[model samples]
Target: MSMDFKIENVLSMNGGQTDSSYARNSCYQEISLRILQPYLEESIGQMKMVPCGRFCIADLGCAAGPNTLHVAQIICRAVQKKYKALGIGMPDLQVFFSDLPCNDFNLLFQSLPLSVPPDGRLQACHYFAAGVAGSFHNRLFPRSSLHFIHSSFSLHWLSRVPPEVENQMSSSWNGDRVYISKEGRVEVAEAYLRQFQEDLKSFLRARAEEVVEGGWMFLFFSGRAGACPRQQGGSGAVGDILELAFKDMVCEGVIERATRDSFNLPFFSPSALEVRELVEEDGSFLVKKMEFLSMDTEMKIQSDVDFGRMVAKQFRAILEVLIASYFGEHVVESLFQRFAERASQNASVLYNSLRQGGGILAIIERACTP
Candidate 1:
């Protein structure tokens, strides 16, 4: 499908703790970094021991702020420390923070703190942050320019929602909220799989060009476990809870059933095997390491009261945005208020249901050919 990515619209809410902060502290970051540290160490070892030369690092899908830079900083320091232990001077590094055009670059720039030492020893650090503004499948940087590329909590977003699904009027009416029945689940899964294939091809091609040989790229995203047709008990609980919540909205006539089915959330959690296959399929990159960790969404709640409040708050926050986008901004508050009442009651049941429905974190690195 020829998809025009509305970068600005998608990132309209990408600020504050909700956007960058939440991701910063997410388990995905913690897990992915653990996998990344060694590869970074090895890469630093291979590079010429230049004491004052510039090294390049890029964060793809950097979003709008310091969160990306913060992660980059951590990586840089770790690499520098590794070199310092070898009695090597620090290399001057150029860090690039890239995202879609619609991202709030002004906010990111404003939030960026100065990176100089008090004594002005020229910390050997220079930053070049910009909005790539186009799909990652397309050209974003020069070939072989990047040493390390990183992205997290993205990649599942298709270049566009499947055009066939978008074009099919009947497809839209297939679900109430996010619930996909046996057949509906199969169809939707196929569509998502197709989207992933297409997007991954483009993404791999683009990165293969930008990343230098032996350089690494780390990606952390959400995906499902096992090959289950219908989301049910077990690891499917989050899907179930979201399905139930959407059904409540449908029953209340808050959203068209068609919209729910036709517009699936732009995310997927691939199995570790599935990820390995993707990495191998590209043939340009080799799978260095892949590990899956169970991440419970329920961990957001510390207490019963907090759980209740979080359920209501998350529902309202998401619903307000959805209602405002599809309906009118005027009805957003009212719609969310009504949804919050129902969400509070459902929170306990949903929390229990999803007690085991955590997420997965995967890290892939670029392989160096002999």
Candidate 2:
């Protein structure tokens, strides 16, 4: 792994059902999933057949939260609809929720409904659920295992920050910034792009070996609408505002400049073109639907305060553990509080940036051959 960020050891969403946990803050993810419903149903409808007796579905990077089960439930519903429309019985489902080993499977499983409902109302479709702990960058299942695979708001996270970005001796060194920014060096962006390409290539290769031919894969993750990663502000705006927060702490001597410089997040938001090129290069999957979606525009922010708090809480749920690991838990709450205040002041700009740095939904079908 590059730097101190290890995919298996360091990456995981904030667990539990607390006010600050990922479960509460994942409304944004739910919106993305809602947007995905039509396409998911379409994919299922197009699939004229599924495995004979049991259908295996895996939700990769299924972080701890209701969203995790929400994704599975959506797929099960779609599958049920498809079977009902075909006038055939739906196959038994073996759903796997896969995430990093550090994830809270306990919370995820506990969130499942009672096995035997007191109301005696049976679920429309029953699924045998299991949690698979591992990184999706590698193979998590046996050969030709998964019949349908879905991942939402994941995949942009690299297995690690590019090694060169952390080396002061390297030209790509990203000093005092967590991600690629307008003020950052082009070499730094190039480093991130290379890492993203490498990680994506590995991801496709692994999934190719695991998914059966003709199975479907749906992926939704952050992306840039522009052709060039440097052309638009996308996720860079978040990095910029976050750097501002860190600078505030630095000025107060709460953290050293070197401490901030040494820290970097393992994230990259790719362009739609970049994703298509990578998928075509991999040659294992045929793109069925690939489009850039603006998730922020769909959100209804009543006021600047609400927008600020929403953005701050959304990011805190994702970055709280990583930031606390690097900067200590003492500063976590104050840092995010300052972030919310700063975000409120720049609500308009932040909204536009987030819209530009929207999400990408790609529905691809496994080809007959790699």
Top model number, lDDT: 2
User: lDDT (CA) for every model shown?
Assistant: 0.56, 0.83
RMSD of each: 4.7, 2.5
> Among these predicted structures, which one has the highest TM-score?
2
Clashing pairs in 2: none
Model 2 over residues 1-370: C-alpha lDDT tens digits? 2354565686788998888889889887777677678877788888757536778999998998777777788788888787778777667778999999878899988888637466644467668889899988998999998889998888999888888988899999888887788777989888989999999999999999999898999998888777766544657888877888888888999888888888777888888788999999999999998888776545689999998889999999999988887788999998898888889888988888876456778889899972
* lDDT, candidate 1, at 345: 59
Task: Give all TM-scores, in the order shown.
Answer: 0.76, 0.93
lDDT per residue (tens digit) for residues 1-370 in model 1: 1144342245332345552233332343455455555655555555533344656777777764444656776767755765687787666666777766655566677776656666645453344444456567677889887777777656655565555445555443334434333445466656656667778888888888887776777676555556653443332443455565556666777766665555444445555666667778888886765655444443555666555555545434323443355445665554445444554556676676545443334444555656
Note the residue pairs that clash in candidate 1: 101-133, 172-258, 222-269, 223-268, 223-269, 223-270, 224-269, 295-358, 295-359
Give me the displacement of residue 215 in model 2, in angstroms: 0.4
Span of ten consecutive residues with least summed lDDT in model 1: 19-28
